[model samples]
Target chain A: MPVSVKNSQVVYDALKELGVGLISALPETWLVHLIRMADDDPDMILVRLAKEEEGVGVSMGAHLAGVKSAMLMQNHGFLASINGIVSGAQLFRIPLLMLISHRGHMGEADPWQTEGGMLTEHVLEALRIPFDHLDHPDTARHKIGEAQTLAHASDRPTALLLCRDLMWEAA
Target chain B: MRRLEALEAIYPRLSDCVVVTIMGAVAAELQSLGHRPGFFYLQHAMGLASSMGLGIALSRPDVPVVVLDGDGSLLMNLGGLTTMARYRPPNLTHLVFDNESLLSVGGFPTATSTGSDLAGVAAAAGIPYSVRVHELPTLTAEFDAALDADELRSIVAKTEAHYEPPAATSGFVTDLGLLENRFQFQRHLASL
Candidate 1:
């Protein structure tokens, strides 16, 4: 059987262990609970930027504030945020734990998401970012660790790709 | 024109400015130009360039922040324009590279060619200045013109988007533990 906890719970557990100091993101259905989980603790600073790009900037500021920061957003927002991702995050070696909503792939019924979905992998590749598909909850912690590690080691941006089952319930 | 020309033109011409762009071909090209960039997320979020730049720019009103974005990426966060428009950062200048495709991912068409007017939308949202640049000469000219505008300026350039694929990593960052240390050293201050 698959891991019984919600995808958000898995994320909260992973982040709780990692001790993510600060986080900024748009409220995502998949990661909302996880974000809240990370928030209850005083050490974790959770801020919602007006836009995904602002989240990236804030996470960088959070870095200044002396905390490991992360930004969680959707695939579409990820696309919109690439410039900052490339220029701001990667250039400055600002490591941000990017937890992205896996839309436009696998049972994707939305027509608008198809194009954005197809571009997701290649775009990450172009950024020279290594991404792991969270197909199973068993892989979630390790994947999150890997991304956070990269940010820590190289000061480069790392991504965590969480799909439907990993993040959401069957609606 | 590629993302390089845009950055080369913008970064060199201006001083004390914050420049941001997306990941992929453009990011590499900008790097090749010998400029130190800020947080470069992998090529996942697009429209966020300006949003991030805005955060930095707002905090440091003394400096100028320019967001070099692509059409598709700009489309990713449609609401960003409204925020930018509403906030109206006088030091913010957004230059979008309109390639009309997700060129970095696959040579697929973006909504830009079909039905999006990002500049128009920025204007509608209350950006003090907005225009479209179909060629470099015009873009360069516009960039020169907007420098003195003293308000939020949205300049859209119609350019061919190109990309050479990047190597794959199972995860983006190398060590999760380092983030704590990295954040500590810089303290988020690029200078001073």
Candidate 2:
């Protein structure tokens, strides 16, 4: 199934409304539209990351410069970025707004993504990062806004899981 | 050139630049000289200083962002080099102080000791200007040019593997805590 362009626009519009001037991301199946949206927007700065961990540092720098920024990646990418999240963002008290595509969930078709999908919530809990499920267009904007607010207020990492319900459309 | 001497020579030139230094000796030595609002000692997260500098440079194209990185840290996230090249922010200057050893954690040898060329890697990664310098004069000159020109540049300075013990720092712990440093830096950025 292809990702829903309508849902992608909802998320992208929400980020822009939230004043996110910069975003760092690694390409993922569910994030194709969002990455393209950011790339095509002249006002937005899209940093194509070599690795997800680099996004953590990018967010930190953005905060230091008073720029609102977000990081977009998949579950496995989030897993790869834990070290930077813990030591760089957490230790230094930088606000990180991460929009992670929740891959390998119940309807997952890929075997490789399953392990990371299963571990995603557990690791997020262990890291004490507050997160919300962006599973519906009705509440996604509110959740993302709240997450961004919490991240800046607490000066720590916050995540919004992009569930399949929000990203995918039935064929 | 030694790391401290290189830093000392360049410290005065950094008044207008936002400098991000990797943890341990580089951070300690820079802090020892003095703490400026534009200076950020990125501690604990080893290899991300370059990434941070790239972000800052992209965010604020008005000022130059200099990353004072080390060989070990640079090796840990060499992919950052590729990413930086991809963006190629004109306001960013990456300075890798290649001392050949991990002097912070018991003097372990890094790949640079065995001849891995960081500048070569950066050049191949597509940075417009990348060079390796083994002398203070050349390092300073390249740094000046990088700052003055509106182009993405990177300089890897070969230095002796030397460590400055904590005792030598005399109990200095960056007067401001981590959060305080961020707030101060943001304010400084606003002023600029």
Candidate 3:
């Protein structure tokens, strides 16, 4: 069974329920659905970043502006953005719930995605940031809510890593 | 040459100016000169001083902002110059100190002077005002003049590619999170 649009919609509904004020997304294959959902929502503030790193900077700046924002970027952007996360986003305690569409993981056809997938855990650890994978419906809603809550309550950023398997299984 | 003169000369005229020195010895030197804590060290982040400075300039256009950029550091985000030009921030000075060598990170050449003229590149990018300096006295005069100018400016100071950098760590905090906060902190920057 191919991952259906419903899965992305399920995640979207959960985020809307969590009160996502702003979302920064790159219109990648898997992320496009969520981007559309976020766009259709009038209350959501969405801004396109020139680069992945700039998105981190914008998120930090917007956080300064007192807006709760999340980043929706391609996994490849993770490479360009890791520095901003470690150097900036994490250090500032600007919490953002990452609605990532996992790329380059085990079944990734592109060679480049493979490298990022292999290093995802190691990279997140290096920054001292905590994250949980969302591949099943049983905990997806709870995990999404908790991540957003943790981002707000603790003032520490949390990541919600979405794997290719989950996207396929549920979508 | 022009950069040191700009630092010394501009401080007297622009009362609301802020400076962000790049990593290595320059940070220690700026610290001794009695500057505020910005994201000054590499551990906090690398090659973001200019970007951070730009954010400040945009937010506080009334106050002057200067980035004490090294040739090597400036090159890493040369594309930023385009954004700088597009934005055209007033009261912002990008003082590029070009020693032609990466003095702090071993004696490797910066390659700043290798292929293109950085000042010219800035001019072409619509910086509105651009100048280069090498001699101390003339550079100082130019610095004073540019600070008083009515438009955005970019200055490239060509110095000895081999001056010994300071060894002490700067008092400046390297926390990007703290610096990006909305509230004003005197500890981070004094009105002086």
Measured by TM-score, the strongest candidate is 2
lDDT of 1 at A99: 83
TM-score of chain A of each: 0.89, 0.99, 0.88
DockQ of candidate 3?
0.16
The 10 consecutive residues of candidate 3 chain A with the worst lDDT sum are A57-66
- Candidate 1 lDDT, tens digit per residue, B1-192? 765566667666643444656655665565455534343323444566666656555555565666777787778777777767765768778888888888766768988879788889888877888998877778888987776678889998887766543233222222212334334325434453
The parts of candidate 1 lying over 4 Å away from their true place are A1-171, B14-16, B37-43, B164-190
Extract clashing residue pairs from model 2: none
TM-score of chain A of 3: 0.88
> What ranking emerges by DockQ with the best candidate at the front?
2, 3, 1
Fnat, model 2, is: 0.78
Interface RMSD values, listed in order for every candidate: 6.0, 0.9, 5.0
Question: Distance from true position, residue A48, model 3, in Å?
Answer: 5.9
For all predictions, the C-alpha RMSD in Å is: 10.3, 1.4, 5.8
Tens digit of per-residue lDDT, candidate 2, span A1-171: 489999999999999999999999999989999999999999999999999999999888988887999999999999999999998999988899999999999899999889899999999999999999999999999999999999999989999999999999997
Indicate the residue-level lDDT of A96 in model 1: 77
lDDT (0 to 1) per candidate: 0.69, 0.91, 0.65
